[model samples]
Target: MAKTNSTAVAAALTNNQIKRTVDRLAALKAQIANLETEADNLVDLLKYQGKGVYFGNAHKFMVTTVTGKRLDSALAQSFLTPAQLLKCMKTTSTTSGRLYAL
Candidate 1:
């Protein structure tokens, strides 16, 4: 029934705290973008110099060529009728969010 020193409970955030949290998230996103760019560059360099698999201190980075398949809409449209094209096609709905400077 009684709380101990180790029992940590979160206090409710104020309106200002909410805004500060959002601000922190926005800054983190920017940092993440920069880090991603640097990582991509490093990966490219490693792929050029290293073999198929890269050895890190605690992890292994495997670089493999990915062959993807997708419908050639323009070519398909030329060959198939409108009704046939509609039958073959699929509508994909995806969700994403971004923060803007206002």
Candidate 2:
């Protein structure tokens, strides 16, 4: 008879659980996107702005202003230059983990 180690079995089960959780999360995000589109359509139909409520749930509506700067490469090359732009830029590094099924 072959003996199986309990520790190995537990680790494999844990990995499988993690993979399943990731799959479930992806499905949930897709559902959320669909729901958000529906909500946006309803808000547009009602011409809602600033705040509102549905089924006794309190909701606050907001208009967000997003501002960004785009570099004029031609001007930058003639004047400040790419090297100068690099000097002002901030670089970030991050580490992330993903679970996969076998």
Candidate 3:
């Protein structure tokens, strides 16, 4: 019958739409879980480091060098604290400026 055929087509379309929605939701849930896991790991690492001590991951020579330059500019506000400058020196290219306590 014509009515039966139309009803079957409508049911198929509804099923297809529901399937796509569920798939998208599952993908979003997976991405959220991954982000949460990364946040938890970072929080745990920070907790392990406690207060005052800095927490940093090891980097290659070039990455370290770039990071040093960025830090020098970035930390200029904190009176360029000795510890920060020393951290900069370990990875720096600059040799003219001597670090002094403020």
Name the candidate that leads on TM-score: 1
Q: Report the candidate with higher lDDT, 1 versus 2.
A: 1
lDDT of 1 by residue, 3-83 (tens): 553323324667998689679879999999999999999889888875588888999888787789987889989999999
* Descending-TM-score candidate ranking: 1, 2, 3
Task: List residue ranges in candidate 3 displaced over 4 A.
Answer: 1-13, 51-102
Error of 2 at 27 (Å): 2.1
lDDT (tens digit, per residue) of candidate 2 on 1-102: 534755445454567786776798778777998999998897785555434433325765545446899988777778876788789779999988654444
Q: Show pairs that collide, candidate 3.
A: none
For model 2 the TM-score comes to 0.47
- After superposing candidate 1 on the true structure, give the runs of residues whose Cα lies further than 4 Å from its correct spot: 1-18
The Cα error of candidate 3 at residue 5, in Å, is 34
Output the number of the lDDT-best candidate.
Answer: 1
How do the candidates rank by lDDT, highest first? 1, 2, 3
**TM-score, cand. 1 vs. native:** 0.68
Error of 3 at 65 (Å): 36
Per-candidate RMSD, Å: 6.3, 8.8, 21.1
